[model samples]
Target: MVARPDLTAWRPAVAGVAEVLHAHFTDHVYPMHAHGTWTLLIVDDGMVRYDLDRHEHGALSDLVTLLPPHVPHNGCPVTPRGFRKRVLYLDADVLGEEHIGRAVDGPALDDPLLRRRIHQLHTVLAERGEDLEAESRLSLICERLLGHLGRRVPPPPSRPDRSGLARRLRDLLDERVLEGLTLQEAAGLLHAHPTHLVRAFSREFGIAPHQYLTACRVDRARRLLLEGQPAHAVAAGTGFCDQSHLARNFKRIVGAGPGWYARAVREPASRS
Candidate 1:
């Protein structure tokens, strides 16, 4: 087997991102290994075969691969000259816990719009550092991805089942947000299917479980920030991946960065 110019490296600029890889292999086969972060891959050329949760997945060129954290998978080419692939390793915390089950169940997605956005994110991240534009693009990518992977809602039933399941899920989330509970864990504990659980929770609570968790983390971070904790310190306490992750979610939820929000809180108390 002849060697080809295969590139595997990291992109340092993006927050909550672990690495970037571009490679074309003729004989290399990735052994079964699991990453703790989300693996978003775009096939640039040829075809590749892999397995997720003991299910085989074959991805052609231009298709997107969304591998959830802690799933053991392996990969090799399906074509003669091997395949070309680009991948982004993203912190699982940034994507939240609700969609992890869907990603694990269906690693190869056929959404063209999602494929395009992921490719665009890769392009932008490769070229420049983290800025407003890059951040905006990342947000959009996540939004579209969540739409695909989140719970599916059908027509509203005349009387929605008010089983109080959503409330129970919310309580569970409130208690477990700092512990980083995954959708599978929650569903197993509740003795329900993950999709049904998500749909019911979203229908009753007006948001998915992961969204509620993020809000809980952000809300906790706010109180901590007001208590004079630094952003980095607050991040760890609130279960954020890092300060950047905290800052991004905090600014989005609070409309200001932690430092600024802290100042605003302090000024009001000082003036009082």
Candidate 2:
């Protein structure tokens, strides 16, 4: 079969996701390049052959191809007619490195139901549907993928230390840093006393809960900025009160303001 011409389109970031790409490739081969975000991919037609961490992987339409952030991988079609694929580049920090590590161990997931659900979520996102509905689907998709990958989600603190209340609190902070959650609220949800929870968290992590939440927010803002989002918008999107608020925290944590960080991150790509 004669190969079709290549086509590609990039969509702007949504929520904690950095960007989406829908592309069709014929003879095109991606060189050795790795994304700064997790590459969650769907092959719509034909197959994609790629190498992750020196191991080759061939993914058909039934499977989802997951490449963890900063891991080297490259791709090309396995068939002459080539392939059509959609990709979601998600902020790595939002997903947590430990969970990503589990997926990286086995990058291709052969779950048809999960694939369909992810495709549906992608459709809603690409079409820019209702914000609440999209958010709901995104949450469900994350939960399903985490479970499918055999990574355990922490149960609420049966005993704080054994259950790792601090770790669970860290996950909670990452999830709601942008949306904002208070110490009292988080403690209530975890069934712990607020002051005790605070002390436990500090003792375990060496940083106050509020400080950790701020750091998470700053990290998220950095990803958005890297995606070319303006500082003001990033501030609002990442749960800061305003652009100035983002600037203050971002400079303190990141050693630069959001604008500078954005330019620094994008300049290499722009030059190339």
Candidate 3:
């Protein structure tokens, strides 16, 4: 008999996160141990049965499990096929110590919204130079977690004007189209919370801040392509991580790949 474990772990540049781990384990059992940071876990395949503070719990694909810091826990697969999971070890300060008890009591949360946000955060964390998007997503995730733990008080409903905030963010994005700023920097400059900034911009513009930025970059790439700049050079000039990154967003927004679009535009002149 042999054990196969596939694991990848890293410490992202984003604040409030201690580490990120993605793993798949077959025929493996974890001994009782504890972490100094909160474990935000999501199982992707199969199931994980674990014991936390002497209480047994099962981690299913749809649920988000939050194990508090310094609490002993052990995990193993619930099935013969084993389980695959993604985990984010958040810093202790990200969630106050006061909420530790609450989390321990209700470690497995069935909130779909939280699960989706955590998945999105993982995607952003995997990409380089996306710290702003990661931080913005993390802020909302923490707020939702606090709400789930019964520590966050819902804000009073007030219909104050938010169009100005959205426009300001738009202008900021436009000004820094090439060298993008972090969500924290925009919030500091505009005097708003990261979550609030995202909400305001989305509500007013009907698109997410990150999506809008990607669109802007793609639009710039189009212009450079038409000007006879190479696709790779345009991608670098327009702030994309690489040519493939540019191509993906370009196809999504422009209904064609960069190479195809460039050729199509030049084809008309060649025909003439």
Candidate 4:
């Protein structure tokens, strides 16, 4: 039987924004629950057993995976050697508008570049290497992912009109996609009750609170693919746990595979 775990603050921004960089190295027990957005799990050490959508998989270094929203899932460390990781919770709406990224169960890429990006994010978050310097490093890391992971637009004029909390939420998500933000976190950041914030955000955003968040991640992923990044890089750089997860989300909104879409763009002759 699946064990249901108790609730902790459940803030993805703090937990998901940067790599968790676990020092505990202990098994993590989580109960099955549905989410509003996709989650990307990046394993840095050892392996993990993930029960996602009622399916299980064991993952180790450089492995990436995506978990869709409203899909029940659970995670358990494979051993006491345990593991350390960076989890990104993707925002789906963004996927549709921008990137074709997905949120899966593990790391998005085994590529050295992807690993370097994660390490850099982790390092900046942990060491705070320098004030402006660290922030610059963090921004560059995200920009590289965007270059590798996001597609190009017509320019700022063509950008969508995302404002207020929705805009802030989306901006925050460009780097930290798969993180789940609690109602409290939302309220604290937005200065409203969890319920009020949800309603207001949904009302103003033209999508549910959670759905908006999912979009943010998806958009970034889309942009990356459009810009000529590979599937694995898109998965890791944009915060989809892995390529499979990116495929799932990409199919949902674009109605086709990212590879196929990218091919179409690259080979204009095929348009005939």
Candidate 5:
């Protein structure tokens, strides 16, 4: 087969995600190198064999491989068909320095839920106006990864009611709905860890913070659209990055696109 390597890499606006890369490589071998950020990888089409900290690992389609920051690793395809993979380069702060040794010890995870969550995170990160969603997804992914690495400590037996914290987060999200809010910003303002904030909000509200924010935006967009505002303007006025972003969320929540919803509201039905 001909040697052709396809790759796309971009830095998202989300805080923890340093970079996102999707690649399909044939006959391309990666030399031993280290990164300043965590490498979270998933193989889509084929397998990748890599060595991390003098031990070998395989990145299979079902596995979520996490190569810790500052750890040396090299990768190459397992077959002539090569490998197709998606990767997320996360900032060191996401996982902390304490987990690097554990990750280096066992870089590949066999958990299906983790692999699925990572996939969902990649999908959210690829979108322009989905920073909040990306942050939420990344938080869960990191939490699961920490669990996999045995870095997560169990909470105390006494469980305090975090409903107040969740309400505060909801209020903050409401105050900044139009301006947009990041998970880190919310965590800082609420004086809670990102994962804790996410858990609290989800548990109290029965919905993820990102989902709540999107619903709010969509509701606002509906009002604006009915008030004779164009779909594009409604998008900009309601915190969406663009008309398409608004359309995607609007359709999901409202069962129709912004333009269609607006038109349906304005147009009178024919008399029988």
Candidate 6:
């Protein structure tokens, strides 16, 4: 599935957390596409049928459907009422600052605590509904999410090729993110096809190339902002079109606006 790219967008403040739309989507379905973060789907009402990788899971309320990043899959409604759900894009290892590519997948769906933590994060997102502190609230949720998943979320993968590819991608983007490199470019660097790259990248890193790229830009921008760089400068340096462009995509992926992230990260430093 192609990402929605043509519209003007803004990041809702999310502390260190980000989320997509939160609504009751009925009969709506997604084709195979990739996302930037781990998605925790809770069936609030009716049922949905989805295939995660090869495992076909029948969706039900109170059951959290976890999609580890980058693995391609699709879903449809088992009931006409469809489903109510939300997606959080970032979690509070403060957005994987310390070698995120190091985060490797060990086992999928064996951890129940990760599910519960994501549910809590979802609750905060669902309840906040775009308030000023909504982001900090979400960050708290993310902190909890990571803390809970720390042990449960599979330890980072150890293969050199896997981590090496991730690091290389980040470095390449860092040189010039504005070139708008496609997944094909990444796959070529790894000597893999786009589809295979999607599967392999997701399986190893928990997100696809596109999502991984976005996260790298966002994190770099975050560090720059903490240095008191102007939003526009940081955005440009990080490979977004401009400040507004960066802010929109940043919020879309990180779940918090640029201004909010900078201020929140700065206040504490100023205090100390």
What candidate 5 gets wrong by more than 4 Å, as runs, is: 153-160, 267-272
Cα lDDT of model 5 by residue, 167-214, tens digit: 899999999999989999998897787888888888888999999999
Error of 3 at 252 (Å): 1.4
Reference-based TM-score of each model: 0.54, 0.54, 0.90, 0.39, 0.93, 0.39
- lDDT tens digits, residue span 1-272, model 3: 86768999999988889999999998889999999999999999999999998899999999999999999999999999999999999998888778889998999999999999999999889877667678879988998998988877345224354788888999999999888878878989998767788888888889988888888999899999999899999989999878887887799899999999988775444543
lDDT of 6 by residue, 28-128 (tens): 77677756666556655677776665667775665545455666668877876666655555543443533232232321333455556556545544432
User: Which 10 consecutive residues of model 3 have the lowest summed lDDT?
Assistant: 152-161
Error of 6 at 221 (Å): 36
Backbone clash numbers for all candidates listed: 0, 0, 0, 48, 0, 9
Poorly placed runs, candidate 2 (over 4 Å): 1-13, 154-272
Candidate with top TM-score is 5
- Per-residue C-alpha lDDT of model 2 across residues 1-102, encoded as one tens digit per residue: 545566555554346578877888888888989888878888999998988878888978989877888888888889888889888787886466676668
Instruction: Provide the overall lDDT of each model, using Cα atoms, as 2-decimal numbers.
Output: 0.75, 0.73, 0.88, 0.52, 0.88, 0.57
Better of 4 and 5 by TM-score: 5
Residue 89 error for model 5, in Å? 0.9
Candidate 1's C-alpha runs over 4 A off are 151-272
Candidate 6 least-lDDT 10 residues:
99-108
What C-alpha root-mean-square deviation, in Å, does candidate 1 show against the real structure? 10.2
Per-residue error for 220 in candidate 6, Å, reads: 38
> In model 6, where do residues sit more than 4 Å from their true spots?
1-10, 91-140, 147-272
Clashes by residue pair, model 3? none
